[model samples]
Target: MSPFEKFLKQLENVKVIEPTISYDNYVTIDLSDKNPDLNKELLADAEKFEIYIEDYLQKNNALVAFGGYNEVRNLYKRSTIFNGEDFDERNIHIGLDLWTKEGTEVTAALNGNVHSFNFNNSLGDYGPTIILEHLFEEEKFYTLYGHLSLESISNLQIGDEFKKGEKLGTLGNAEVNGGYSPHLHFQIIKNLDQNSGDYPGVCSKNKLDYYLENCPDPNLLLKIN
Candidate 1:
């Protein structure tokens, strides 16, 4: 079976959200049309906002599809709200985002060893992130789960073992999760190269081929139409 098929077979009991929350409901200041500074207060308290998200999930206990960090800054602009930083097309997103509340449970896509974990607490960076290494059918690949709460890595160890669909950590708020809307940025990486807790979630147009080859569409494994 292919990598996507293998991952689908393992997501039998995963919980997810349908009709992900809209981008408008994600931020506080609504920078969709404004040219604000990177540090502008466009988002609210993650902890407080997550309460509603949690309640919504309980009412709509659907299949857990996928989870990771997300941003609504329209990465394709080649320039971000962050310090007027200009980037190439590679800066655009190439991953799937699972929209939900803060503190949402993040589970592993498959059984794997803890490759590395870190607190990437920078402006617009993944607050706390985790990467897993999986070996299936002699094919090795990595899963990157970003924007996690600090406690997620509080007691984590390098090379730790985790089972498929096991709880890894809770989603973090905008303050702690790199100042953006609450969502998971999930990606399937075929080659890790030398990356650690963080990998390129966004890439430029020039580097699209490299990213596409190394990181396939997460939906292939999620199988969520």
Candidate 2:
């Protein structure tokens, strides 16, 4: 693990969703190509995908389905954002996803201030997104909350402070959350590289090594494993 990742692991009381839901209610899900139950057909349509996720959650008796950091998935094939003009295909998910109901509360992983937030409106994009700047052990890092409700960013200003587990925003629905099932795309970014409010949550094979290093598995902090 990188030094930042190690520090994250040592931190305490990290929860990104509704604090009422305990850890036991969270289940790990596999959305990679290897998961036979998930297919192109299901991923191609937002409503279908939401239905599938609902069924999976019901079957597993879990409120949240989380996973997909560094997992190669076929879910992006339907979106030209990852495929257009770039045959390399950014299908390798670099962020851990927490799938749950629309409008579910999303909180900060640590005490931090809003770094940047934007409405990345595009097909298969991180619709209302927010990035928080956090400092610990005298080291600075960032946390991104993507696929958020439009209201999430409506009243935000730069440098707004939020305590750990405090409500940063709520999850967005398919209509505004890039046409996917309502979920929080939570990622830990070591460096923003001048980017604001958004970063690549998926990567291509050629750039996987770099992205994997710069964006470590968020589960290291969430400890949802």
Per-candidate TM equals: 0.69, 0.97
lDDT of 1 by residue, 63-144 (tens): 2323322224442342242324364433456567665667778788778899998898876677799999987668788888
TM-score of 2: 0.97
Cα lDDT computed for each candidate against the true fold: 0.64, 0.92
**Quick one: RMSD of model 1?**
6.9
Angstrom error of the Cα, residue 159, model 2: value is 0.8
Positional deviation of residue 93's Cα in model 2 after best superposition, in angstroms: 0.4
- The number of clashing residue pairs in each candidate reads 17, 0
- In model 2, pairs of residues that clash are none
Tens digits of per-residue lDDT for model 2 on 109-207? Answer: 999999999999888999999999988677678999999999999999999999998999999999999999999999999888989988999999999
Error of 2 at 43 (Å): 0.8
Top TM-score prediction, candidate number = 2
